[model samples]
Target: MSHIFPRHSAQSYPVAVGGEGCYLIDDTGKRYLDGSGGAAVSCLGHGDPDVTEAIKAQLDQLAFAHTGFFTSAPAEALADLLVEHAPDGLDRVYLVSGGSEAAEAAIKLARQYWVEKGAPSRSRLIARRQSYHGNTIGALSAGGNEWRRAQFGPLLLNVSHIAPCYEYRLREAGESAEAYGLRAANALEEEILRLGPDTVMAFMAEPVVGATAGAVTAAPGYFKRIREICDTYGVLLILDEVMCGMGRTGSLFACEQDGVAPDIVCIAKGLGAGYQPIGAMLCTAQIYDVIAAGSGFFQHGHTYLGHPAAAAGGLAVVSAILQRGLLPRVQEKGDALHARLMEQFKQHPNIGDIRGRGLFRGIEIVEDRESKAPFDPSRRIAANIKKAAFEAGLICYPMSGTIDGKHGDHVLLAPPFIISDDQLDELTDKLSQALNAVI
Candidate 1:
């Protein structure tokens, strides 16, 4: 018996011993194609020499440095590189260990910014339903995934959740995608008015909703209008790009495709590409200036805020994404993957919608395509599909509670940028097998 505390206490899992390009090897030597990049973290696939070398070199020089006392070169360089390519107005970076830390920091920073700006009343937050930010208390409260928040309701801070800009189910029958997006975006304004704009500090959302909603992109003009509303209300827009940023969504920053730059942004997952755990929260110059001019400290921290080796790994991963021309490649390959998924499942009776951008795609499963009704929660459709995919030698991300917190199912596909055409076919073939075995 193992002494480790597993994610699922009752379920047993195969031991992952090693990984290559896009496949993970189990203890028994079974090669499972990594269809989801292990929750969209390994963008460069299992092993990359460049990132490893950088981390190793940094460790040899200096493995750790507490931020309370000093800042290291790797941390400084990483911050500079991130800001250089970040969206306009985002001029500062706060490095952390992972997505949860990033989200926590973003929340605190938003609140503090308002306080420093003489708006302490702006302490409330607003987010979208069916969105997943991170797992920390503050992040969890900001996230609208009900299933994840149910048990912790007593401890969570109060947050207003508006309807998600999900076109598949939320858009009316005759509404155009663009019109539906505007209507959806207006919900934020309504909520802000209901809560009073001055009482709200930030509006947080994933650029491409991940995990909970499974790669759900906003309808056209949704984010643009959202940005406008934030500006009008003096509310900060915080984009959580934890699972969809980096090069996973074709663009280095997912918000770029939406043509909107947020006042603050949280990024992780693909930032370090599974080489080292790293995430960052970036803010605009205006937000930074207010705090700098007021207290000179943001008043939030973590022990590993800027670990030298983790910073080195993130620096290398980001450099590889930019220098190797992976951004365009992600776009090209994303189109290919989307086309292949459509070709394979578009006509199927059970597959309701196949959507996403870049290498990040999602397949919503429905009992009836016309009604878009989900499989019964008791059926455990997502869990079974995941098991079947794993058994078929493919590693895919399937999740329950897609529509609400308990009604729908979806499989999120986020393969590495280096995935080849042949591998794409392999992925589709194995996914078909899994679906056949399940639904």
Candidate 2:
């Protein structure tokens, strides 16, 4: 038996030996197209020379520097780059090792900001049902995915979950999409009133729900209403862009498309583009000023918070994204991918819905398209599709419990920004074969 523990203990996985562009090669020389970018992390594909050289250079200068003692050049530069393109009012950055840490920091920063402002009662956090932030205890508490939080319930903090702005499922019959968005966004106001707005510290959500719900986009005007409500109630709006941010959605930040900015935002995945493990939590100048003026410290950190090498990787990855002009390409290519998917799956009985933005897209699997009814959980549709896809030389992200914690199934496709027209067809073909194999 292998000494290393895997994600799934019961199953043995292929040993991936190398990655070239958008494909991963196994030890046996089998190549698998990176359709989902390994949970949407590798936005630059793989084996990027620029990113590698940057990492190597940084390793020579400084690999790691304890943030408690000294800060590194790469870390500082990375922060500057992030703020340059950050949403309005967000001017500070807190570096972390990965998405979970960034999320944990965002939550703690929200609480501490309130404490600094002398509102000790602002302890409750409000999020959306069917949303996912991270897997760490504090972050998990804020996420509304019942399945991810079930076993850890006893340890999670109290969090109020409001309905998500999911139009396909929650929009009532005969309701306009815009009207449904407003109604869904209003749920936050109701929750705040019930919890006494003063007691709620922050409202956390993803601009585009990932992983658990696939690439579920919000209805029009949803986030604008959400931002207005947060401002009125003095609640900090925290946007978790761990998967949807950093040019994945054709914009540097996914909230840019929503036309609303958050008080705090967490981002990862595409930051280092899988060249290095990294994430960051960004906040407004006002929040930083309050903490700086009062305690002079935010009071939360990890040992690897700002490792130089990781920051170098992130810096290069972002620079490549901006300098090479990948954002607009993402838009053009994404539209092409969506068009191809619609053309291919328009009549697929099991392909219930094809929706998403830019390179990040999702296809909901269902049993009844007219009713939008999902496949039964017992069918293990998502799992079966994932296995079939992998076996057919593709790597796609598919998950169950898309509707709630157990009702729906979806396949999330987030290819690298460098994916080509031919590659898009290859992705759809492989996905279709997988779906056919399973359904």
Candidate 3:
């Protein structure tokens, strides 16, 4: 009956009519709490006046500018602000419309940087398993989610997938977290050597694995070892922070907590919150210098790159995050949320694990807690849980194929940084109801 094309045609969809704070209102007036920040996008929650005002002001002043010949003030200012707050050596920003675009740009930039640097043989990419980069072609190829990549295998370029630093499932019995981290990181080295390091252009991963692995954080020292491996092999480190960055992880940049910075980093979602769709691929000065000194052009372009209004929204959103002191608040709320989850679900039959940092957390479901055995894929536990959550006026991210391409389930929760204590309790209560219904 609707002219609009939906994501899943077989399933009816809710028309989100309005949003305020951490709740999204449907046409029927059901207010669903944004438990996962709508795939971890809405950092400041919905309808923040500051961000909307910035967008309106930018549209009134300069609505459109073709970046092929011109650069706008908002774009420049946004880039400057991002670089100012970015990890050391990450000195440039490439603005795009969303997460996929950012990932695509990062991939191309990494390859192009090598080409310009006279290392054109560096064409292969290495990423960790159970990671989700973006949906675009290049990004998809770089991502290691087998389920997402299966149908597109023929079209996808070859990429090496090393074992992810997922400690809960991957760590051996009696292994310390720190030791397990180093072992997990060494997988990259093994793959790089197997493929020949010079043939590899970049090693991409999320600081905290999102969507596919359900907010899995790396073991301690995992990324530090990863950084060292990249440096050793002359490979570029590309951190995909699409879902976990922008104060979602109690830090402006998720990599900040890891105490390491990547050569190129992709960020989106929370950057513009839900105010505007904007994402950026940030790189070090060295990478930028190599291309600038060689070709003077990066040889990549998107018509919507650096659109003024989007940049304005991103600028305003980030400004509010910093100026209003939301970073520390995320940390506080995150700790509270984590503690509450542990208190409530530590002994839950279906709740196997509760893990993550800041407001981003994951509750892995299991058939047996002692075995960490996942519910059968045919059971569709994740899908049913989602339906139950939605019906109960809760909006959380529940995903299948959490352990591999088809074995596990997890509910990822990343609420707005501004969520209050009462809202959080509501989230937990609703989630419990959903679990009770399905699990």
**Candidate 3 local lDDT, 296-390, one digit each (tens):** 99888889999999999999999999999999999999999998899889999989899999999999999999999999999999999999999
Cα lDDT, model 1, residue 281: 95
Please give the RMSD of candidate 1 to the true structure.
Answer: 0.7
For model 2, residues 246-341, the per-residue Cα lDDT tens digits are 999999999999999899999999999999999999999999999999999989989899899999999999999999999999999999999999
In model 2, the runs with Cα more than 4 Å from the true position are: none
Q: For candidate 1, lDDT tens digit of each residue in 1-439? A: 9999999999998998998999999999999999899999999998799999999999999999899999999999999999999999999999999999999999999999999999999999999999998899999999999999999999999999999999999999899999999999999999999999889999999989999988899999999999999999999999999999998999999999999999999999999999999999999999999999999998999899999999999999999999999999999999999999999999999999999999999999999999899989999999999999999999999999999999999999999999999999999999988997898
RMSD of 2: 0.7
Best by lDDT: 1
Write down the RMSD of all candidates, one decimal each. 0.7, 0.7, 0.8
lDDT of 3 at 102: 94
* Ranked candidates (lDDT, high to low): 1, 2, 3
Model 1, CA-based lDDT = 0.95
Clash counts for all predictions: 0, 0, 0
Record all residue pairs in model 3 with backbone atoms less than 3 Å apart, i.e. clashing.
Answer: none
Q: Candidate 2: global Cα-lDDT? A: 0.94
Relative to the unseen true structure, what is the C-alpha lDDT of residue 9 in candidate 1, on a scale of 0 to 100?
96
